[model samples]
Target chain A: MSTTPAFKRLPRAVREQQMLDAAVRVFSRRGFHAASMDEIADDAGISKPMVYAYLGAKEEVFIACLHREGTRLMEAIAAVVDPDLPPDEQLWRGLRAFFGFVGAHRDGWAVLYRQARGEQPFAGQLAQMRTRMVEVVAGMLGRATAAEGREVPATELDVMAYALVGATESLADWLADHPEADPERTATRMMNVAWLGAAELLRGNTWHPSG
Target chain B: MSTTPAFKRLPRAVREQQMLDAAVRVFSRRGFHAASMDEIADDAGISKPMVYAYLGAKEEVFIACLHREGTRLMEAIAAVVDPDLPPDEQLWRGLRAFFGFVGAHRDGWAVLYRQARGEQPFAGQLAQMRTRMVEVVAGMLGRATAAEGREVPATELDVMAYALVGATESLADWLADHPEADPERTATRMMNVAWLGAAELLRGNTWHPSG
Candidate 1:
């Protein structure tokens, strides 16, 4: 073998990916506060200085991990959601893809998300991600309504999307906690809760308070 | 007047309440980390030492504020929710009470809850509160199903309740952000989203995957 190390030969992009993978594992295992740079570097088989040089710092590394994971999740859902299909079918596919992603990355979803949820800087990033999710859901709802030859106010669509996204997020938290839970079954459960009401709304039915 | 200060003449319960009121206002105005004991004491017209004696440290005071506010919120909802009423009506009343409370204390909801959500110790407290809310919602759902001479699995009820609570929390966040939104109208919108599907489920309808 050559004198040079194998890792040294890898491209910067590949090295960064390796660092992120290790960082995600460490963050998931030890949590945000307790996690250390040494562990991440050791896990990646890289020197601590090299890890820092490449990813800036632990905070930046965690953010990179979050961005990579979050982007993957969004892409997964988007890939399965076909606008050509009926809206309900599109929603079902999207949900399946979402739960499936969470199921596969349970540790990542639990620690990274729960830890970030309470921290200030990380929470802002999460809010931005949530806003993107809400927009996507609102767009889907708008398209669904348009297909029915009915027009709902954009604000109403936004509100409904917020409710759906919140409900799905709650269930994702539930799934993260319950390792034995089936992702597909969870998706079906969500569809039941989401679609029945949405279908009713699509038909122009609404609940009014009893005066 | 006597040499003893007016505040000293007040009973312990009254003094503690005053301290909490000031703490809530300070925490709301300055956020959890940025809030100071000096400001809270100044607002309460008490010395810093007296504020500390009454509520322990800053963290403890924040916890105290959270407990008081959370209890008041629960009480408000409990007072309006009559089990003898139909499930939908009970839900509507409960939602109205909840949104009304949030509307009235928009600052508290926006700051205290959001700040606590990202911190470790406070997040646990918030989780406990969420669990209580989920249990109450699950109980209501169970009773609703029982009244219809039908029974759903407790786990299913719990999942549905989580979704409902999550959705409501999301909307509460939305409402907090939108100062002009009407609480009662928000409650009505939630009812339309929640009850229509729940009514269908009560009538033995569920969504299944097409495959």
Candidate 2:
């Protein structure tokens, strides 16, 4: 009747993260459909009931992973991005931090954030986060535009935000593929495109088709 | 029984396309997994055996739809994009056609192109097409930069191509959402970002982290 060391009670936060880590690994491997709760529970080394007790059902578990990873990523970028700094610096820090996060948490970024885009169930959650990111970027662009005494049209500005976010996500996929690539250098390249393009637009530069 | 009129004998190409159109609609509605052979066959007014005879199985049917939609999209863009033109014109036309295809075939874009990215079975197919696109853009960048008598590092050039492609795909999603958004006009706005940013890079203008 000695106390069992392997079955020691874990705190809620630690257990939840454990479940999520296992969940991400499983989901990344098997996708959302083939991945089973039993597998996740086994992978976490916790019973199925403990998984249910900490996180809800499978969908809830997936959402928990998305929320946790997405928040960690957003916060990682947010922490370094100071609004008072020049917009280029803000963007540089943000992109660097973003690539850094994805580089470090490849599984979370791949399974939770990147893979979630294709599933309808998670689209709302993903869109909410994307909309927030877009708004932040639009605000940055607006501030920069005002500094330059020019403006981008509203609808156009929205699409620009989408383009910028999409570019980062795309590059995130690239970074995930090339583990040897430097996140800082990737961020620098992205800044070259995004900041320069955005600066041109905020300065009211436009392109036209002769047709 | 005198006759059975349920299965009409159409040309192979037309029938294949009909099956694909049905498959895209069904896949978009039900997703790649939940979508069944019975449902898709019924939707196309063909029997289950004919579906198998023509399209093989569920995975094959999904791949066929992806191939069809992806090819059509590529052709549309290629028709408008002339490599002989300036890089900006080439990119502008290419983007306009891409957005147009996505706008017209939102269902295909979502399910076949976008959704397929998450599922492992289809990732290879999707990646093949995307890699081709990245290669084309990279070649264009090389040409554009050489025109400016500057050279972007090989890895950075690869990533710049990825960033540009990702930006376009992100805006394609945006175009899919806003049905009223004009594809050509959106292309102009995108050009303003992509071309300007790219042009700046070709001219050796780059953003740096000052901190």
Candidate 3:
């Protein structure tokens, strides 16, 4: 038998991922403050010193986890959306992907996202990720409107995108909290609210207040 | 001249308001962690011990500010909403009041609300306020659907309310960040997005995914 542990035989990249997976579980279960590095190392089947050497301190480990999860979420959405598809289809697909990710990773959504939302440094990172999502949504809206020969103002598109992103996020939070809810149905409900309003807007139908 | 200071003559209720105003300003300028009781006292023109006597510690002072601001926001929305009015009209009035409040108190929104969102104790308070808002919104939605002879499920109404509240909150955050933005105009934009979709839903029009 080899003297080295089996984990030692793995490549550095693979080891790093294993550490991140363990870290995510710990962070999810214990939150940012209560979570300990020792637990993370134990969960990863690696020693504490090796965990620190590989991913730095606890905060650094958390940031790495956040970055990985965020990247995975973005990649999940990006993989499904195609510019060539109709706007409604793109939105439906994007939303379905988003809710699916949240549903599957409820713990990650609760701890990484909800916890980071109110905290300082993590909030900034989360904000950066949100800005990217808003930009992507705005681009999709812009393309959708252009296809319909309407030139909506960038600010308007941005605001609408903000609303959409915010609404979707709120639903994701709701989904994370509800263990019995179906992600696809939640996505469908979102489409009913989002796509309907967006379609009405694209059709130049405005809701004017009646006195 | 009287031996007592001029501030001493003020009623307890009046004095408390003064302290809270100062606390809100300090908390806004210097987030939750960075804000100090000393600065709050100085700004309010009250003594540090007096400030502590009135509002307790820094955390308590922050909570007091949050409670006051949240109460004011809820009152603003409640005052504008009338059951006799059409659902769309009621929604418009509520949204206008909400944006108006946010516009008038951008600092409070940034500090009291945003800062509390990620932090622990304050986050719980904020969630309570959000739940109240969601309830109010769901009630309005239920009334609107009932008037139209539709009996929507409570869970569905709650979900829709969550999406609306989330979207509105997102836009309010945007408005707070954009000093040049007009609150009324922002409210109108929100109306366009919200009312339009809600109107469609009321009319029994739903967006279906096309293969």
Candidate 4:
């Protein structure tokens, strides 16, 4: 008798990834509430039991998608930005990386930014990613200001970072909606709006309320 | 027998509003998917049939809530901002009014900004409001630039306004999460980020990527 197994079993890692890709696609199409395990399993070409075994319940599966995609986006930006570069250059790179990631994974972007932001448990995942991104952006903002021989109050810097990141994400969301928009050009447009404005602040031109 | 009717029938306008208030409360607490017509009707002190009679369906009820609150927010900002004022002052007043509206109706803010940005019918509602707000912001951005003796490309202004509005919405989201935060102070923080950055862009501090 031949001793070889009849079918080759995929590794657990490969199976998990396949499950997540299917989940993100289905969730993007069906939304979190309408998406079903059967559809995701079928999309993965696996049994529902296999999906549950690898990714736990429906909620866990959605969260797994959020974690994976969120990590990828953060890493992509982090990989490109250099501390020694000028702030505009660093921001340009970071935005290029971000829009590139979103352009590459439009479905994942929809699931993470569009879908998971409503429900409580899933919203937390998106919020945590946002918090981390805000901190990273804040650090970059602070470092750049210090290099320019200026200081933005820490409290104010925090809000500024949040606003910059928020604005970038909004443009990213816009890119996600328009399938043909060029990420590089879009990033430049964002730089004009964000960094140009920020440069003025760096140059100590701030708005004051009149009495 | 007296000609007066024993029971008062709430006019369609009043009844429709009551149903919306109930739906907003339920949707805010239970989320869009989990909220039930029965519960919404119960909360409004009306019967299920009556809710349907006034609002049409769950979907329509939700849209009605969005329409009402979105209109209210726009009106509040419109009431405060004067076109005759300089761009900075107009933006300041707009931001202040926006934060105040959000603070006063945190639940409505969640339903309008956070919860409704996902899914189809609901997302469409939010997107429409965002489009309106973007156009207004774009007009303001255009006016400010023109006042400085220059004209920005229409396409660039569109994206620029989008980013600025998105940042303000993010701060509004932050204010939604924080119950203890003061709306006026929050508005000031946002103005510092948005207006200062905008002021620089107006001064022609554009970022150029080196070839």
> Highest TM-score: which candidate?
3
B18: Cα error in model 1, Å? 3.0
Q: For residue A57, what is the lDDT in candidate 1?
A: 85
DockQ of 1: 0.71
Task: Provide the lDDT at B153 for model 1.
Answer: 98
What are the per-residue Cα lDDT tens digits for candidate 3 across B154-196?
9888888989999998999889999899998898889888779
After superposition, which runs of candidate 2 have C-alpha atoms over 4 Å from their true positions? A1-10, A34-39, B1-10
CA error at residue B174 for candidate 3, angstroms: 0.6
Per-residue lDDT of candidate 2, residues A1-211 (tens digit): 5253655545656777888899999988777888899999999999999899778899999998889888998899889988998888888888989988988977667767656776667867888899999988878877877787776567766888889998998899998888788888888889988888887777777677766
- Candidate 3 lDDT, tens digit per residue, A1-211? 4465767767877999999999999988988888999999999999999998888999999899999999999999999999999998999999999999999999998888977886778888998999999999999999999989999999989999999998999899889989899999899889888779988998888887676
- Deviating ranges (above 4 Å) for candidate 4: A1-10, A146-153, B1-12, B34-52, B56-58, B146-149
Task: Give the per-residue lDDT of model 2 (tens digit) for B28-69.
Answer: 988887899999999999999999988899999998888888
| Candidate 4 structure quality by residue, lDDT tens digits, A54-142 | 78899899889988988888899999999888888888999999999998998779666787776677777788888988888888888
lDDT of each: 0.89, 0.84, 0.90, 0.84
Model 1 residue runs over 4 Å out of place are A1-10, B1-11
RMSD in Å for model 2: 4.6
Candidate 1 lDDT by residue in tens digits, B1-211: 3465768767877889999989999998988878999999999999999998778999999999999999999999999998899999999999999999999999989888888875778888998999999999999999989988998999899889988888898888888989999999989888888889878887889988777
What would you estimate as the lDDT of candidate 3?
Answer: 0.90
Ranking by DockQ: 1, 3, 2, 4
